[model samples]
Target: MRSDLQIQQDVQDELQWDAILKAAEIGVSVKNGIVTLSGTVDSYSKKIAAEEAVKRVKDVRAVAVDLAVVFPGTIDHKSDSSLASVALDALKWTSFVPEERIHLQVDNGNITLEGELEWQYQRDAAFNAVKNLQGVRSVINKLRIKPGPSAHIIKDNIWKALTRDANIEAKNIIVETRDRTIVLKGKVRSWSERSDVERAVWSTPGVLAVQDELTVSL
Candidate 1:
């Protein structure tokens, strides 16, 4: 196991290495493998990048983002309607996003997505569509995955995916499907393995939600 100070430095270095993040403006602190990022960034996307960088760093068990978005006066002075229009257009242009299904609203430059998507990646793509808009202060993804049937099949497929991934030890994990939701209960060696397990399950079609209850054994 690595010390807290070592994890702190690794997270800081990762922030600096990520091209999108202005590392100098971000503060990093670590305690018991949990990294806390506190500072200010020019854009919401930059703030997200900083947090994601910390999450990817080795030995990081969790991330607490306390960073604030500090937009300059000249950022995007457009009306909220114009911002919404621009974001809607961007979503339409993105091939992966189901432009017709997901509905969005912009209030004070905060985008709120509401609707159902077929897959988690599609819902994520909907948010990414307008994540970097000039006036976007933040995004609230209220979109829910469309519920589909066959709990038995979902359970079996998720189990197979977990066993297929070499990084995850399938024997220790339990897969339970109730309706369209997947409830994962088990212990993993690290935070990364838990994430990988959840990602694998989400890739299975007809999955509505993932309830990850996996504990870190390390």
Candidate 2:
């Protein structure tokens, strides 16, 4: 049986992936608590978005991103190198991120990315660019998102809602809301909590939709 921390991490990471997919952004697979990200993104930001989405999960040991680039023919040295270049280009071109902050390295078809950006959007841009490369097999993202007020507010509201409910344990779950879309993460001991939490979020005034990533551990 997984511990509470492990369960929390798994749920959060799954929620992150769901956000990306719902936005028509990218696709990810989580197996054995390891995340594999894949899909084609228009910009590098989308790639980073997918990876960060995975990293936010509490129990994720690591992520293997296989997202591809939109333009493949222009930079042709090797699969990994091409993907790296695309990622770099996306970061360099984006007005939101400074060139000095983002770094890229490639080995064969596997690309490694490192950087610090002002927002999750910039970080995701870098990840998306490399994940979708033509021959790229995997990507490892070591990037961080800069903090903001919105993130804090979302966290607070989600926490308050979860803890207030008798059926939900605050420690076992995580919550995130984007533009009124409430996403619930964590493992529940019973199905009642699952249904109850979904209803709780849906009842919240600002929530337009609720994405439940809850798992039942029987």
Best by lDDT: 1
| TM-score versus the correct structure, for each prediction | 0.91, 0.39
Q: Tell me, by TM-score, which candidate is best.
A: 1
User: Number of backbone collisions per candidate, in order?
Assistant: 0, 21
Give lDDT per model, in order.
0.86, 0.61
Clashing pairs in 1: none
lDDT of 1 by residue, 1-218 (tens): 88999988888789889988888889888888878899898888998888778867777777899998888887656688999999999999999898899888989878999998888888888889898888888999988887665888888888889898999999999988878888999888877788799899988888988898887774
Q: Pairing residues by index, what is the TM-score of model 1?
A: 0.91
Writing each residue's lDDT as its tens digit, candidate 2 over 19-105 gives 444334455555665667666754444566666666555555556878775534564445655656666776677675666887778
